[model samples]
Target chain A: MILYLMCFALFLVGVYGLLTKRDLIKLILSIAVMGYAVNLFLILFAYKKDAGIPILLEGVVQGSMVDPLPQALVLTSIVIELGTTALLVALAIRLVQKYKTFDITKIRRLFG
Target chain B: MPVETWLYFTLGFMILGSIIALEIKDILSSIVAIGVVGLGVSVAFLFLQAPDLAIVQFLFEIFAMIILVRAFVKKDYHAETPARVNGFLVAISMLVIIAIFVSSISVFKLLPPFGQPLFETAQHYVDHGVRETGAVNLVTAIILDYRAYDTLGEVTVLFTAILGTITILRIRNGKNAGRKGA
Candidate 1:
């Protein structure tokens, strides 16, 4: 499908950003982009046509219900993303403090 | 025309957007592009009948963008020098590999089809799991009870990461507290 291909292209773009970008902040941003792309791909995999909400109500049953599993998984994944972003921000702050600049080239203290 | 045609077009666009996001020189622009990718993905999820995942992906995508922007405020967004590599070759090779991988999987139908026997077993687990484990969500029941050991290991790994971060961030004074008294 055109939509699936578009999603894949977006994911590849994010990957390219993460791999090619030299700026530390940009690198982090690219990585986040990559994460978003993958998450999107996963969500897209579970879509269905003409499905109603997954929630069950009394006395009225839906003929077709949306899949609920992916939603729960996505919620957990979002929390994980939050944790990762927090750590990334903390690392960026420390990198700035130590190097006095955001340029990745100047911050070569870690390289052997 | 069949709906499949539109789906194919959207898929192509999604792929194009991903490539652009990665290739772009501007970090901020790439971040925005990533957001677009997320939106596209959520829409795809809706089409796939996975509303739950779509909602979660939407929420996480927004959160990630905000975090990236906040971290890079007043910070340099470009690399002074690019890494030395045969870019074209690498890209070509990667594309080939991905094509091969995708084609192989699709051609062979490697993934288990939905509602197969395996899925039935999984469904059974979900149906009876909560009653046995006292967990409300079927997935949660599986994660917390059926495969508890794996969850425990993951928790340990998380704790280790936190500990490492704390240790790295700790400030070392000139004199140790015990030696200061001596």
Candidate 2:
């Protein structure tokens, strides 16, 4: 479907930026973009047309709700992503403070 | 208008935002572009009847926005020298990427069609989640009751991440504060 293709293209655009970008923050942003694209694709892929929310509301019929599995998976992944982004940003702060630069190629002083 | 048509339109906007986010030179502008992409995706999630994901995504965008703002100093982070990326290498990489995506699409054809539950176990949860877990939301029942162990691990990861951040930043007791006091 065009929708799926478009999402994949967006993901590839993120990958392209990740490959080409020099700044660490930009690289991080690209990674997040890629993750977002994948998450969106997964949720949409699991979605059934005309399905309502997964909640069992009063008097609501069962078996007609959208899939809840992907929603739960996305929730957990989003939290994990928050942790990762936080850790990376902290590392970035340390890197910038120590090296006085954001270009990753220039900050290669972590020798054994 | 059909919801699928709306979904397509939103996906197009999201794609546009994604391209802009990656292509723009300014970091601040790039941040805004990514935010727009997130918003568009969240809207699409809602359209697909995943309100929980939509809410989480909406909040996640805010969280990411805060992180970007926190990192947003006026310092010049731009690399003065242009990157020497080889055109031929990039072309090859793109080709490989396209191949992977195409293969994935073909494999997706093997998956259960949209809206159908793939597993019988999941169907049981869908039917009796509220009565069993006492949670009205099926997602809550799944994550909290059926997959409780996974949730526990997720919490542990979150805790460890907070610890790692603190360790990296040393916001708490600095290295050898006890020794100095002694």
Most accurate candidate by DockQ = 2
* lDDT of all predictions: 0.58, 0.79
Tens digits of per-residue lDDT, candidate 1, B87-143, equal 786687578657854764454354333222122234455446546877644545555
**Clashing residue pairs found in predicted model 2:** none
Say what the interface RMSD of candidate 1 is. 4.8
TM for every model, in the order presented, reads 0.64, 0.87
Model 1, range A9-96, lDDT digits (tens) per residue? 5555555655545566666656665665666545554444555544444577545443445545555555566566667766776676
Those runs of model 1 whose alpha carbons end farther than 4 Å from true positions after fitting are A1-14, A37-51, A64-67, A96-107, B1-13, B75-109, B112-118, B125-182
User: Model 1 chain A: which ten-residue window has the lowest total lDDT?
Assistant: A62-71
TM-score of 2: 0.87
- Report the CA-based lDDT of candidate 1 relative to the real structure: 0.58
The deviation in Å at residue B83 for candidate 1 is 8.0
